[model samples]
Target chain A: MSDKPESLTQADESALMQLREEIDRLDTEILALISKRANCAMKVAEVKMKASGNAGAVFYRPEREAQVLTSVMDRNPGPLGNEDMAKLFREIMSACLALEKPMEVAYLGPEGTFTQQAALKHFGQWVKTKPMPAIDEVFREVEAGACNYGVVPVENSSEGIVNHTLDTFITSNIKICGEVELRIHHHLLAGPNTKHDKISRIYSHQQSLAQCRKWLDAHMPHAERIAVSSNAEAAKRVQGEWNSAAIAGELAASLYDLEIVESKIEDSPDNSTRFLIIGTEQVGPSSEDKTSLVVSMRNEPGALYHLLKPFNEFGVDMTRLETRPSMTGNWTYVFFIDFAGHCEDESAIKVINAIRETAVDVKVLGSYPKGVL
Target chain B: MSDKPESLTQADESALMQLREEIDRLDTEILALISKRANCAMKVAEVKMKASGNAGAVFYRPEREAQVLTSVMDRNPGPLGNEDMAKLFREIMSACLALEKPMEVAYLGPEGTFTQQAALKHFGQWVKTKPMPAIDEVFREVEAGACNYGVVPVENSSEGIVNHTLDTFITSNIKICGEVELRIHHHLLAGPNTKHDKISRIYSHQQSLAQCRKWLDAHMPHAERIAVSSNAEAAKRVQGEWNSAAIAGELAASLYDLEIVESKIEDSPDNSTRFLIIGTEQVGPSSEDKTSLVVSMRNEPGALYHLLKPFNEFGVDMTRLETRPSMTGNWTYVFFIDFAGHCEDESAIKVINAIRETAVDVKVLGSYPKGVL
Candidate 1:
């Protein structure tokens, strides 16, 4: 029953010390390269500001960043997988971007929402993120120049689209600067004083509650399920409650000083959400990109058929097509479409031209780099 | 100014009495007609039971109900709008259906969720509704025959699809008996003694907070937004809190004994959610119907374009097409497609068969009557 540490042989200890020293040497080289990259980014910022003749120059180029990440993944000769290697480069790039210009991002929040998680994932930890009360406020923040850019959830693999985000685009002139997708993983968390057996209630966002419905039902059926505005808020509420748990993420657990009761409780293994990085500047193509458009079509028998024909004819790959009631008239509808390719591509131009001929109106929301992480 | 009432004259009083008498007579006739309808429904149930050779008869027919509502709307000649008139019939039909069978429904709830409201709206107030903690439990309830049917949100006009509901369909064999669309309206409510100016916190579901983001920012900019499981849950939490308000629906307000501080506070005027009714029995076509399908596509160039071409060629009007990552492999996707026709229709069959030629798999989620109310 004795708990004693086993001592290593003198020869083994020497080998371990050598390995540690070698790791430290590699870290030193990596640090030097990261510093050099940051210095280069600062120089690029100065040139951009001078060329634009103003301090309000755009430093966070999504297309450029996407290309960098793509190249990192493509050329990775890794013991680590491509995604893991690119993630390390992603942080390095984010630090460099911050050096170019300190960026502030606004997101739908009461802090630990998946939107905030997506923002940090996309921009890296270097950028400051502000939690807006609403999706529109996120847009307003970017549009009003209060924040450099805003991040909003556009769609969820399990929950569907965030209609408010799309509707906000119809009224606001903000461009879709980039796209990022984050896999949603929910955790059951509780404060330190909480008795696991005495848990009487569970709190979460309505969607989160729905996402973890099966796990909750199977494990804690008697515990009352309370829907909240955000998972972070749920964690915050549970922080002061002794007999309750919150279904949030690891970030929320860390943020609220809670312990994980259960992890990755979402019903679907591939549950994920797609977020849009909205800003004033339109993003260029990164070779691989997507274009989103809002198209208002005539109320006719074959309106949808005609609207989709150009994509088929031009061989453009459509990722999504969603219908919403048009603001102009009753029974009239508008379609929100996402397709592969930059809007400026030759085939894209022809497709847009053909759609405009038949559609009542077509507004390209933006063409931006596809999500890299 | 004088605080005096203008009394009616003797002639006016006599006219009012005559009108009241006439209204009472009309009410009697309406009651008799309702009774006759209920009697007819009971007889229909008996016939179905006898045909099935047991009491476990499928008494509720969503397609039949849709037809009844459609005819009631189409043939109505009144001061009330078509929707209003059909609503009255909906209640009547609900009452008649109850007489045939005391249907029990399971739904995602702790009581005042939009899902519960949708269930009541579709099934009417007569059927008993049991609130389930999760979406899968609702399916389980119906599958286990604990409840005759279940109601779950499928998609939102603004929020997007309820991925849990769709994912639940992947493993569950429940048939989508019908669909019901409800216009979502949120209210800012508080306990009667709460001071509006002193309110420091607002409670609601995350989506509700997003939906009412603009209204809250414009009115209660300084309040801390709290996310909860459901709007009803928010209303319940706000009931005893003097310094807090809740964003909820009229149903939650009434259920929780709260007063509306503001009405219809959602940001989008046309904000709505679509719900699906799940049962063991399949629904026949109501002439006007929609079919939902889950199609898994191969990872190839123009896979989407090829999948959509058949729908266009067959003239099967596609309403929605949503993509989600497939469970089978990386980079593979499955689409949830909704089109304006039953699965049995010639055009729909042509389209489905054509799609089967290229798609990896296609599962007919259901061919249910379109939402009539």
Candidate 2:
């Protein structure tokens, strides 16, 4: 939406106005379609609730949602990329899902954290998100039916794995329902009253400080860098300090009424974090799916090798394998593994069975769609 | 060491005093032994410099240090556990190594981060630690030979992998020299002047707040929780706020002059983070070692399955496998894999060669000693 060009002739201006009007008309039709979709979703909830006697009707079908997203991207002949097109549909579908059932998602948060962002991105802004103090609390909130689902950080491209999340899975019966990945962008922000040249201090989380080290060193060499707990808190601190600025995100900038001093200051452009959507009920297979499993192995020589052989034999694509010390044995370890395909698939079933032959225990976490956005 | 028991008789008191004297005498002998070790280290450095014509004298040998630490634990007839005994010798070796060459280490830091703790834990307190604001800076500092080694957080048990660290490896030539794991403990702290009943706000990094959710819910539910950038920053913020408390670590508490209101308040007892030591030089094989590799594969139907076949066939214990989008390709992925045994091992070599037969490219990140603490 560019402003009317000053060099445009009267005829061209009239043509531009007509184009704008046409866009407005298309927007109206789009709004009507969205309303129709929402109404259709409410009917879906009614049918589901009535069919299940209003007991435990699972409105959120991972496979179904994945199918919808896949079709949206596949069918899109867009001016935008497939990902951008799918994301627009993602929000539409999320709103529709909420109409079917208002999802209360518990996320690891104090608000404005990357995990919260992932929750909204996955569930859409319509679902109510409650900030839980810890990963396990998010699990407990969902387990106790206080929330329908939970979102927690599972891995980062840089960080290996969230050990606590994996550990929680070992003891808790919570199932992995879905997944989302969020690109992390850190911005340098300050209060409006602060003079850019006079800024003497910078506040950010330790990782943020590290992520933006070169930028800070080159741009604000004199500022005393203060590592805070969260970027949101750093933005909060800057609100009360004239000589201080914050390294945070757009969310925190708006949340704390801060101005962006410098944007996208992270050292690596590829920095992104992956979050897991967890719930009690199992997720059905999506078009492109991934299955998570926790396998415990006795402390025998070549234990890890034996546990992974099934995937190689069955041509199953293994995505991730993280080792954690098992709680039950002296020197035993458990492997948190993620492999392609749903558990119900023949190859996946065969692989799991084969792993179980040598493994002390093999617990299927869940099979969920691979992240759409 | 404990004080004399209150009910001790005259003879018992004398025996206790004698034991204390003996301990004091042993400590003096230990000091002499440490001094002797330092002198030996200095001599070793001199010999290395002379042999290499002072062009490059590698004073710090990861494998050698690992061997020493292993022997220390193995020979320990301990009232202390193997880990505790090894830690004591770790500090001793650190001091001795410092005497050989004053190693300057760079780490992701704003001074009081867990990353700094991991750096100190891995390198010992004797080396001068320089806090770099970013992970890549830590890598660059080492790469540029500004620092002897660099430490960065590779993963958190609760949060997963640090993507920037891994991404940096793809473009940078920094070597993984060693690995260390630190158990994370979050404490509720406040300024000395802050009244316990008047803690209207609680500050911490988002992760810490999540980690300590249960403790806060049970203890201070009414307080407003604020997420900051780092726990140290939270501790720093609480120093001037009479009505605020911060959840941080012991380092943050002392660094910011805060009093601990509660200790070890994380939701999960197993909360920990793993850090990587990056340097310019390759490390030789240690008794217990792990090799890291970055393998890029073509976008094939069963690319992941084919990659794992070698590890399975060679009976290599695959510990970790993380997938990241390839930088050069639209849909291709690069796997950051970790497995038991050094690159020099016969099985590891066979596996690497087998993988090379099918994989587009494989880059050996490093083979380093597994974390001892």
DockQ scores for all the models shown? 0.01, 0.01
The B-chain TM-score of model 1 reads 0.82
Give me the TM-scores of chain B across the candidates: 0.82, 0.81
Across A167-224, the per-residue lDDT of candidate 1 in tens digits comes to 8888889989898887777789999899999999999888889988898889999999
Q: lDDT tens digits, residues B1-373, model 2?
A: 0121133456544653454344334333333334444555665555556555675667788877787778666665433445644554566567657666789999886544677768877876567877676788888889899999999999864345788899999998888889998877778899989899989999988878888899899999999999887776788889889999999876566557777787788988988889999988778887999999999999999999999999999999999999999988876789999999988899999999999999999988999998877
Task: Give candidate 2's chain B TM-score.
Answer: 0.81
Q: How many clashes in each candidate?
A: 15, 28
Worst 10 residues of 2 chain B by lDDT: B1-10
Off by over 4 Å in 1: A1-373, B1-6, B156-159, B186-263
lDDT of 1 by residue, B27-106 (tens): 33333334444555665555555555655667677876787678656655433345644555565566667766779999
Q: What TM-scores result for chain A when each predicted structure is judged separately against the true chain A? A: 0.82, 0.81
Quote the positional error of residue A167 for candidate 1 in Å. Answer: 49
lDDT of 1: 0.77
Candidates in order: C-alpha RMSD to true structure: 33.8, 32.7
lDDT (Cα, 0-100) at A196 in candidate 1:
97
Q: By summed lDDT, which 10 consecutive residues of candidate 2 chain A come out lowest?
A: A1-10
